[model samples]
Target: MTNRKIVSPSDMAFSYMGRIDFSKPDSPLFIYAGSMVSTKFTGTSVGMMIFPHLIYKVTWIGVIVDGIQYKFDLNHSDTPVYIPIIDGLDEGEHTVTIYKRTAGSHHYFNFCGLMIDENAEVRPENHEYDMNIEVYGDSVSSGEVVEAVNYCEHTDPAHISQFDNSWFAYSLQLARKLNARINCNAQGGISLINGAGYFDNYIGMETVYKQMGYEPHFELTEWDFSRYTPDYVIIALGQNDANPDPKRIYEKEYREKWKSVYKNMVLDLNEKYGGKARFIVITTVLMHEPTWDDALDEIVNELAMDNVKRFKFRRNGAATPGHPRIPEQTEMADELFGFITGWES
Candidate 1:
């Protein structure tokens, strides 16, 4: 491993994996690499830290840690990438890369700079994939936009009052903090299960993830999970499930069925990855009623076990009238960040 080769479509490089090309006004919000080494090998537990580069104008940005992805606000005009050198990575050498779904163009840009603890005692560099982070839910997770003129376009609507890269929603904020490479399977108007039940011709969670681009690279499903099994899965669903009408279609039998559906989904994922990873099931930010929180809690508590530790049910407080605004999402992220890394607020 003497000859180190670095490739960049953009002329940017650095040493010690610390900071590089960060001086650019509108540079990629995150840059780094990750390893699957165990904490025993390195004295630190690995994680990613994000600094918004702009004076708080980076509306969107993300990073892939191990394999489980995380996102954060692109608000700050400038900030540096923070990849925690943790001790849970497997004993070996792994490559960690960061990704950005450019806010305006909606294009995916993948880059690398961060590296895991190389100073560890047992330097076993032979693992293919280290970790995987999967985000599942409705619109927000799917990279959806309710106000955009078309489905293909992504824009913060005019009605949005509080606009700050730092004020961006919580999902993106937490993603950056975790330094996780992510697959955002959320779509606006989506639900715990298939949103098709709500919107006659709406996109579904699994379908969206499946339909993601694979032009030069193979789809996520086609990729080998052996390189890395999804270590963290954050399911932020149930926003649309808060329909006031008990007679709504997704209600009635759907309520009872949702628990089973959600439980089975987690079980299936656990089964797929051999129960070696972790799952975090989240409730809505602000639903129609508080009872929905109670129901979601019941489902997660009843179903999650073993490697899958369920965090307490979370809900955002009040915000602007129309939708779940950025402020609300920030509050939600505050809670979620604490849960994921066990970090104090």
Candidate 2:
């Protein structure tokens, strides 16, 4: 047993996946698939400071230590809570990783810091990936309900926090296969137009792309495009926009809107990021609609952006209502890996 010590986010080998605000050292805001914390420590017990937001309602976190995963829930709250990670270990050296498993619509949280044993030597891992990729999508990208037994088994909130696993999402899985580091800027039910049906408000990807944090109350910070450059940018959107609801589907207008929004997004990304990345626009496998696929193809062609391309996944069975399970996600990742590598070749 050693004395306890406190470590700041800056001290850890922190890798932020999506949009995040690190302006404040004490309370760095993690939004969407915003941040992932990884560090090596020599201690018996580890704890973290989690500040919850009341607006978004829920925060689900996935903690991985020595390859085992544990889920933690930090629901709506005003004050900060200190939760213990694990205690009573051999206490030599251990690697721990913490990541956001919830969707982007959920409220953001401030990862205050970490407390560990005093005598333990904490160091950041030297893990590095061969390539850097950024994926933008909805529930699929967020791995929402990926762990459910079936499409109907885990539909409730309890099942959601228990089953959603971002680490196993197609994007991350593909990243692992290609030895690439990825940032998943995704939210569940988000679309190019009005957002998903579950939420009350309409929050499109275009509107929330630049937000510092998902919640409205969090101070907005202009994301620095140059912060981290990626070799590939994958855009997986439109399922929500093409919702099965008759009221949601406006064939003519939807097609035009999709084209316009997609074109603008591509152009904006190229301009801001200096056209260095290859953008891949994708359609949802869950709702294999030809019309939607055609719209995406047109966007790529009309823009004539040589760097932009398109790819669609083969429809695999869903795990939850509309999201792919781990097995299906694995298939998607395999497809993506081949596509990306083939493109590179």
Q: What would the TM-score be for candidate 2 when compared with the true structure? A: 0.89
TM-scores of the models, in the order given: 0.50, 0.89
Instruction: Compute the lDDT for candidate 1.
Output: 0.44
Candidate 2: misplaced stretches above 4 Å? 12-15, 54-59, 152-160, 194-200, 217-220, 243-254, 316-321
Model 2's alpha-carbon lDDT is: 0.73
For 1-345, candidate 1 gives per-residue lDDT tens digits of 112222222322211111122233233322211111121123233343344333213344544445554555544323345444334556554434344333211222233323334353322223334334766665444333322322212234563212212213455556556665444444445555554435324434443333333222222223233433566877776667544344443455767876776777777777777887778866544434545556667776787475555555354422323344444555666777778777222
Q: What is the C-alpha lDDT of each candidate?
A: 0.44, 0.73
Worst lDDT run of 10 residues, candidate 2, spans: 152-161
What are the clash counts of all predictions, listed in order? Answer: 68, 1
